[model samples]
Target: MIPYVREIQFEYGACDQVSPLIRRVVANNPGPFTYLGTGTYIIGKGEVAVIDPGPDMPDHLEALLAALEGETVTHILVTHHHTDHSPLARPLQEKTGAKIYGCAVGAKAGDSAVITEAGHDLDFSPDIDICGGGAVFEGPGWTLEAIATPGHTSNHICFALKEENALFSGDHIMGWSTTVVSPPDGDMTAYMDSLDKVKARGFDILWPTHGPPVRDVAPFIEAYIAHRRAREAQVLKALADGHGRIKDMIPTLYAEVDKRLWPAAARSVLGHMIDLVRRGIVVTDAPEPGLDSDYRLAG
Candidate 1:
């Protein structure tokens, strides 16, 4: 089968108007992983707010500034600390004199800890680290309330747009591809819980950072949760049927997938393995099960 496909039709450097209050500028960093680069969302009217400022690239920053030429960027909010998701917050903050806000970066390590997706900006310190809900940013005919949906990463946040009844779903729930749950930064348990948290919320549509907007919110979320459960069940069966290592188990689980994506697929399998280990259903040869660790069902 082919590798993971991205359905969103986007061109880098084009600021397309998605709605009455939202204008999206796609960055020139598209790849197998990033899809059609990063979508830097310009929200609100005259005085607007930017979400997920994208990479701190020269052209992307210029595009963002040019998008808000006459308007002032009052605030900049990022969903998480990933390079593609953030990094430009600092530059934009300096250019527009807006305060940057996001969750704290995952703790840095020296190669001893479990692997996570790389290139997190540790220097990003927000003037006000929004503690998810209870805080609201009100603009002209719009209201943005932070949703604490920490699944992709520990500090990920999805902003709920009150006026449109939509959500600025960052990497947490992208319409293009499933969010990668890489441990120890990503927790399958927390990821599943956050999906439930989002399901319980009231939102009509989702404007994800990577791909197109998900209009079918309820069914999409339900399918996402069900897919994860099925994956977990498959992992359990792999262990029960004498397959242990992630290398061996991925083929059985993702045989329809292309071989090139197995590495990324393995990371996701590791997430399930870690979740199983935590729940006392699986055990690994290594005390801390990383990408290369061997796993088996618990006695």
Candidate 2:
């Protein structure tokens, strides 16, 4: 198992026959080229299912294939089509004869994928679609359920292992920084709904696509929900304080937010602002403007 930044180590197939699965750190396109993601491998019944194949890195792909040796990869499950999480689906499929699966929907216009803020392009059109909330993959002693959790991306899905009682929470929950809710592609309402959906379900271990696995899920979910609510309140406060456009609100709203990530921070703020407008918490001249528009909280 290779060790990378943030004390993350690849434990080959520790979860199943696919023991010692590597966590290859690929370059995140947006801001500072930081490393993110924990690609998982589940080898069973002479077939393998690799989740979130991660970015299109030749070395990373090679590492995955090398780890597999002669194992046959049956499916490549994507949590979302985010560039960092799912870009390698095609290539990995090509090499392993694995089928790619993600949300049935296609890309939407004006989505954050167009911005290219991250050096990596997250835009994708899946080969196989898994729309339903629960799709099962049974093998050996495990049954994996694909649970649709749309919020960070419209097509995001989390996988749950019935036998282990673990949920492979893609970006829906991460150990590192908070997941970004970029507009159009990311919906705050759906995000909150999805979080509730997962929280309602009983699960012990959370195998997030990024960062380490969360052993204590209930508290984590509560903290995540509270954090989001707090962020919304902060956004509202910034607007009430006379901060207008997303750009203007960034400095005060995310004062301690990383400067290099201000662009992403702005996108998340836009998502909140849009939600606030729909809820009548904020007033705007035009519902959805191209750019540079003022926003103020409703009196």
Candidate 3:
């Protein structure tokens, strides 16, 4: 289902109680990446666990604090270290004295050349690094099963709520827009693998960090996998048609796409090219494939 702004009827700063245990406070940091806004969820009542505190904005924090007027924030769980998702965790931790948990040790990007500060929150380091194993965090009335579904970023994760039969999918899967797999941190191979990983779990619902909830997760995952596969096919066809550079491929593959989003599209194209190079399906002139690097079908 398409996540149009008109369909999402929630107002900013209002703590809409979605469930008996979960309350959502969406941040007003809407952008191309953050469709509508960042959804900061407070799971459980009395002693609750805050998921994705959203961007470091005073208003958003006030809204969260207001929502938890009589409640205590026990755990502040972050899905990833993206600026829009994790920066507010520190401030919330300072205020509520809640322990911060997230993927601390991430798979290193090839290089930080393509990385932007606006996207990555470099200062974010969790008190408890919940990576590697499938760690289950239990509390007063809730249990969050941490599943490491790294794709959008190396440290990316999705948490399944035992109480609700749902997964806080973070930015790994969103109904608003297709997850952007931009390198050097964004690996196309890892992303596709993670999609398969998430699909296998088969959760009842997926509440993304941005946009509306995905109720039909199985079909959605299938569609996601199919979309990526189609993009990969397009990249292959572009290579076959002798469009070597990522810039050329962007125009050819994403002709109908917005001009402003083409740079991001180029990065995604580079991601696909690098993945193809790794698979020996495509070869590049440079040792590491880049935006300017030339690519071709493997001999």
- Off by more than 4 A, model 3: 1-6, 105-112, 116-118
Q: Which candidate leads in TM-score?
A: 3
Tell me model 2's lDDT, rounded to 2 decimals.
Answer: 0.69
Candidate 3 lDDT, 106-200, residue by residue in tens: 54643566564337887789999887638888879899988887768888878899878899999899977778787878778989998898889
Instruction: Name the better of 1 and 3 by lDDT.
Output: 3
User: lDDT value for candidate 3?
Assistant: 0.84
What is the descending lDDT order? 3, 1, 2
Would you list the clashing residue pairs of candidate 3? none
Error of 1 at 15 (Å): 1.5
Better of 1 and 3 by TM-score: 3
Q: Compute each candidate's TM-score over C-alphas.
A: 0.92, 0.85, 0.94
Which 10-residue window in model 1 sums to the lowest lDDT? Answer: 109-118
Q: TM-score ranking from best to worst?
A: 3, 1, 2
